[model samples]
Target: MKLDLIEPNAHYDMAHGKPAVLEYDNDGSWLYRLNIEPEMGIPEGQQEETQIGWKCYEVRGYNKATKENVKKVVIRSVIDETAEFDLVNSYNKHVLGIAVNESAVEEYKEYLQFTEDLDAVLIEDLSN
Candidate 1:
């Protein structure tokens, strides 16, 4: 499955030109960080050295009229996919800089497992 990066909250901002972030929420956001050298392709199922990024924030569900709400989830960073690093496109791609979410952080075990699973599927595709 091709992954897509999801931008976080409105209050956040991207700075440093390196993709690092500054969070303003009282409850921290989960971050998922990845640094991809577009010019250099990554192996499937292997964790690459993509610049670290974070995903934080709770997706909540609330009653429409009353506005009563509850925190549904606290997700650390979402996946980052600004460029493709496949073999065919490898030569054309450039390893620019890295990216970070100014909004959130990742849940440790959850992020680890998520990345592992993502790597497995992506690797299989890359091999073919």
Candidate 2:
């Protein structure tokens, strides 16, 4: 699986909350997960306009699978799109907490990037 980010947004919010807005592109569409405070802030505006930081991915070969894509196929098969999003939302709040200061924006972005890079690494390993 050559995992390219289709779209990603993770943040610490006080109101409508979630830690990460994770979207995976599959079946020619995108499935999203909002991992933040359940009651944090609303997701408003475009990716660049809002305080939210977004990540976009480009999947290499979803329809056409190869030995390299096996891990991605397995992971996606195991992960239930909707359920994982809910779980992440709850877990992120429990573990990371809500936004306290303006620094949260940068912090959340960095955190999300780290996790995302981990995901990329996993995909690369499987692809190789």
* TM-score of every prediction relative to native: 0.21, 0.25
Give one digit per residue, the lDDT tens place, for model 1 in 1-128. 11334333322222323322222233443322232212223445767854333332323322321111111121212433332123213322322213333222233334445556556533453234
**Model 2, span 11-120: residue lDDT tens:** 33445443233333546543323222233233665444343333322233444344335335434543456644654565556556652344444544554564576466
- Model 1, residue 87: distance off in Å is 32
For candidate 1, which ten residues in a row score worst on lDDT?
A: 65-74
- Residue 95 of model 2 has an lDDT of 53
RMSD of 1: 19.7
Candidate 2 Cα errors over 4 Å, as ranges: 1-62, 66-69, 98-128
